[model samples]
Target: MKSAAVPRSAPAFTPRALACALSYCFIVAPAASQNQPHQGAELPAVVITGARFPAPAAESPIGATVISAEQIRRAGVLDVNSAIRKIGGVYGRQSLDGSPDFGLDLRGFGANSGQNLVILVDGVRMNENELSGAILASIPVDTVERIEITRGGSSVLYGEGATGGVINVITKRGAGAGAGAGQASGYHGSLSLERGRFDQHDARARVAYGQGPLSFDLAAAHQGTDNYRANNAFRQKSISGGFQWAAEGTRLGMRLDSARQDMRLPGSLTEQQFIDNPRQSLTPNDHGSTDIDRVTAFAEHRIGSLELAAELAHREREVRAAYGLLFESAYRSRQTQFSPRLRHSARVDGLHNEFVAGVDLVRWQRDTSFGSSASQDSKALYLRDELRFAQLSNARLAVGARHERFEKDEANAMLGVPAGAQSQNGWSLEGSIDVAPSLTLHAKAGRSYRIPNADENGYRSSGALLDVQTSRDLELGVRAGSDARSVTARVFRHRLHNEIFFDPTLSGGWGANTNLDPTRRQGVELEGQLSLGQAWRLSGQWQHVEAQFTAGPNAGREMVLVPKNVVSTRLAWTPAAPHSAELGAQWVGSQRYGNDFTNTCGARIPSYATVDARYAYRVGAWEAAVSGLNLGDRQYYSNAFGCRSGIYPSDGRQLKLSLRYQF
Candidate 1:
């Protein structure tokens, strides 16, 4: 791989730090410029779909990065994974089969990375766990209208588990202007079919229409493929539908989504398996299956300066899998949650003040046919207020707090454990100050605590209590940029207490839940976008992470899979009227440590880089595109943890072509 264009400097600012700085700096310029006094029929107020108040992206105070719908269509991305991977400061890890179940490494946080990043679908959080973490694999992108990305901890306005950042996925809404300016009225829809080089086949369709106050959207998709390798084959089916009703001061909506997946489990093995026959590590009957269903109903009311929103949702999830000769498991889980929020915007003492408050209540139940059955409940209330100090040039201050409680119930008597529960309370404070019209500084320091899950705390046939994981994170950063160029950088440090992990030394011998040590992770990221001309654009980024087991039996050991370096670059060209071209490449460094700390890979897996290219053309109302993934055909392991068993090589060359029409 070519060396990075930017010089490698000491890792000072991490992803969290850079994100904070960039966010503070980016939010001011556009909003201040858009707020300048204007005349005549004020260009129809643009509504920011992710926020409660009706504010334009260019006028809202919250730091936001918008990805236009046109961009997605032009890029010919299949789902959310392809859509956001190109964005700077973003990293992802996928299964050997390249399915959507990926672990996101945003900035520096690892393992269940989405736990700190919140995702909202039309202003409602998409997180399903009692801990409130995002389930990216379950979210369908077919109905997404736009995406608003806010870098940095958002617990102040959003609730817990918002330490990394917030990514709001806005769904299509009617009664607003048509997708294209001056294209109101009429109906539109699209259908696409894709067949890639590796026997990958996908078919999708969507339809939508609006007359006045009522509108609806329906979409469905199916994808299947033979194993990229011996044990990587998989199949998936999904369907979703939504309806909306809007009037002068109120809007109501409902949505239903479901997904089913059948996956072959390619289990990795010990040193013996690698020396013997690696291909034999995956059994013929070893497989994993999942089914998820969700329903949500919400209402919004806008009365003058006050806006009120509320939502009720239900979700059911099931997972079945077989693990080598040790154990075969089947898990069923259900969750119900209620969220209500209120926002008020007005001029207080001649200064623009926005206050947002909300409450979340969740109830979740889990049952393992051959294991344990348990139920957990949690509730939280949070409030945040942003004040634009009147008369202060490009300055703003924010304050917020949250209160929470957790409870649990046990039903499996064989475990010989009594039914007991634990409660945890935590709070956070965040602030941002724009120093100049183009530069801004931001900081957030918060304490987050999570109670142990049923399996971690109550299930113990051998009489052992699983430890709870808790942490305190402090972050700071700065960002600067303009129309022609933009740069973002950040630094952060996290301290974990009693970091419960897998024990890896029991009868079943897998990583069993246990709090064994203290750990820390800190890093920095630098990213920039440069537009050389109207038809030419260049973007690049670099990240460095350093995680340590500061104290405990694992002291001084580097965290697993926390690579020291990550980099990427992209060049886009639009030379003529009907065609556009793009070339991009990404590099991922090697990572270590095995399924648990006890088992470790002593050698580096080697770093590898891959390239992607695309060609797109438009003719009247019809658009066509062809794309190639891993054009370089570089041989690498996507899942190095399982590579020793030869079960996780990256997919071979994949090519896809698509065509769409607007009716």
Candidate 2:
């Protein structure tokens, strides 16, 4: 095995992205000096992105964004992946299982997306301990109430795996959901059906009942698609429900969810094959199947500015798959988790103060048909405190810390490994101040870490454990908004030590997951939304990241699969009546292909842009929508294992029509 001998051109930073970053100063000028309350309505209504913390959105030390349920319906987003991409401004690559499940990258942590970022459903960790990552396709958008995205290292609150960021998907519980809007104490039901290209079909139904202090609902969803590529068919079925009782600041709930999925793998193609017909599959008969069951119980109580909250969850997951038409295996894992936390507010020395503390206990075990079994147990304790002074223009200061320990035992029927014990410590300091009525300034510095997971530890070039990954993070940002406009701008950098990643250039191309030398990730991010007149609105995001090895063999070289520039913008006509329309465009800059660790790939993965749109009509308890994805019919490949020959081309174009009825 060898690195590609020829070199390819890299994408130059675009002027538009630079201008978008530069223009933030101008947009905040007037608001920078005016002291006033937020009097205007926002696109999604600002809220705390991370559920663990109760701080206001404006005072958050990190970049945060929220996408509401109404926004999801207007955009015709069908899954969590699509909602994250189109509305949250993250970039996602089509997964082998299809569009609904994707590998989403944030802040340029490419290739190992699932490891770097954290995904949560109702405050339960969804990320797995394997390279296969989380199962996201099965979460129907219709069941979601909102999605919260927070950027920068959040290990102090989410655990060791949150170096990139965190995304929390909140589900609807009827009754008091949506702050009591469109929800009353009564019976409710809804049904939805959809059809699209490539024989895609979907059905979803929900039934709910709410009566003073109690709300219960049940939902089921089914989806099937003969995807864009040959032999790439996917099918999924899921049923989920929950019941909640709330009254006088006390809340109690229990949720149960189950899902199954089956898909045929359509391997990769060579550069020549991609150029000729990207839709063809090299390995047509390969396939996979997955089954998952999860249950969670949660409780919260409030008393005298003191809040107590907790969640207990248990999950079972199994996957059987064949890759490259030869390798075959089955994996089964069960996880049980208990998380309890509380928030307390107090006034001391004439200043307002807030305090938070939490504990996490997790037990996970796994068994594989390939003669392997492993188990890991962890315990963590964390605390955070913030102080606010009204005399200093409502300024706030905060600090937080976390300490976690892990114990593991793993082995193979054919091979043996030593049991291990490890621990990680993290800390953060941040502050924010209201510079003007509608403008805020903030900064954060933190230290974060990640321990090697079961799968990564299983594959070793020397048959030994890998190193723990760590990073020092820094950020500076501003948030400004008014009646008709809103904007957020931030510049951040992370200096890393022992960054964990797979090295294709290792062990003579046999490939191994290993920790790399010193590395750095730095970038600029801008997000804004503007209301145009009464019926029109515009929203967009621009991001530029530099991911490079600072030392070692690949020193000064760009990391694989990390695009340097990405831009997304949308224009919408959202009148108050019967018709609504939306148009969106995304341009992703090119970067080196996966496995091109030496930065010698013959050709970089080419840059590409996609256009999508939707139109909807509604008339009393019923709505219909027509939507299209990749309307440009762009031919592109976002993933490749080693080089050009390992390319997996993305879908070209597709359309969908859906109808919904409420009763």
Candidate 3:
């Protein structure tokens, strides 16, 4: 499927959108107060991810954020990245190729962020063994029940690729057998349609049924768009389904998901080219397509005070791309994973304790058209214990450790023996205490590691395998406030060694994977939210980071593509029943470019701010919303290549109108 190119002179807001907005306003204005509903109520506590078992975020020692399904619907965002970007201490940018995939940065890892951060769906690892990172587009927003983010290292609980943090996306599931079977007798479903600027169109449907010991859910979605820039268009289709069965003491579940996407890549623009016309496509002929299929099955059983669970999952993906008459390539990857966990709780000497142990095994293979084929096998085991001291002001302590091994094999012997086997171990310790009724203090320290991936270890330019990247981190945090409002502040520092990075100075400027000297990343994060009455609410976050090499040629230089300061704020109003509006602003500070690791290029990306707004109304089973992004029409770039040769521009002003019906 293809969409016609949107003209450059198209207006940001069309007449039809304006008319609809006016009509909605007229219909909802007078009836607002008549049906006024309660607002500013506190939400229920939810389970936090990156932990052995379900626990409230406020009680966990780790810094975390939970984005609820209601919030996702209110924001009217189509992509998971956009929904996550609204939170604090997170930086997300579109990929350079103009695909829906996003490059994420957490804890100031810069270009290595993709490998440092771990993303999961329903507790299944989504981070591939390759360099493409997570495919956030595969899981549609309609299927997400909630998303949980845990900042800082979590290798003890989640294993590898969690040096920076972890993001776990939890999907919706049916109720327990015999609990809601009578209430679920009827069909429940929802349909949504969205139309936006740049000729963008989206349609989605979700349906579910539950009876006795069986329940099922199915969803499908399609989206197409003629993007702002020339030769940058995208079309995507996805379908997903889930089934569950419950018995006396056991529950079984299975899920199947698939997605296909085709997108035209406009490439990047030079500094002069950007200043002249940001929408022009220098590489108009570049394009790419991707197909993905995944299936997962899980079972759980409870006996006395112990619970046991196991999962088996498989995923396959194929990618094809052509780069403007220069090169065409095809790649395929298949991965299979198995994990089993056991948890038990008990009380020892008046101290409540929970113990958890898990084992994970994963094997994956990749084949590329460039005669590069490789397979990887990884095995890991982890154990954690949490103890609560009710006699000591509700103090809590957690300690955990993990061990992992990696084996790599090359299809061709010419690839230099496929890099040697690698192994690493990590551990974490954290403690928290309640000083007062509304004040808590916590401290944490941990060591984490990440093994090199196929592209990083088996590069054709250099037939050498890099050592595992390792880091030690320490953090102190304070949280104070009541359930109605809260404030959180944290200070953290990380010392890194053997950091793996691609160096353009090696292998005749084609770039090679190399390990860097000692480095450090220290930062502070502040976040607060308040309710000023029943109708108004406000929240904001501020972060500052200093990331640099400590002992190297680029010593004392800031890391490339890492901003020093970032700020975001939002204000929301709920005047009456079924009506709400939110306005948000985000400011990003300037930073060095990708190829200027030494900070001697005299080139720096400038700072910029953008404003976004959304208004939503719901009555009965119908919802209507209008959202505007980059309302100020700001021009900014998230990433750039060296020498100012390739800069990727962000989208300009865009407005979307959506309608949803549920039954």
Q: List TM-scores for all candidates, in order.
A: 0.84, 0.93, 0.91
**In model 2, what are the clashing residue pairs, if there are any?**
36-437
- Candidate 2 per-residue lDDT over residues 489-572, each given as its tens digit: 899999999898888777887888888989999998888876665677677888889999999888999998898888888878
lDDT of each: 0.64, 0.82, 0.79
User: In angstroms, how far off is 162's CA in candidate 3?
Assistant: 0.8
- Which is the leading candidate under lDDT? 2
Q: Arrange candidates by lDDT, descending.
A: 2, 3, 1
Query: Candidate 3 lDDT, tens digit per residue, 562-661?
Result: 8877777777777767898888887777777878877887768777778899998989999899999889877778778676766888887889999999
> Candidate 1, residues 1-663: lDDT per residue as tens digits?
221121123235344454445444434334543333322111332556433444654444344556656556655677765666764336776564337556566655555466556777666666654322445455556676666676555554565556566777766663233332333554666777777765788888888776677777788888877644556678888988877777787888898889888887665544344334333335555778888898999888988999998889988888888766677888888988888999998896668887888888888888876867778787888777777765675566666677766666767777665565555555556656778876777776776654455655653324544444566767776767654456766677667676544455544754455665787767766666555445665566667777668876668876655666777667776655588777887777666533435325556545667788888887877778889887866555545443243325555567888776666
For model 1, what is the C-alpha lDDT against the true structure? 0.64
- Global local distance difference test of model 3: 0.79
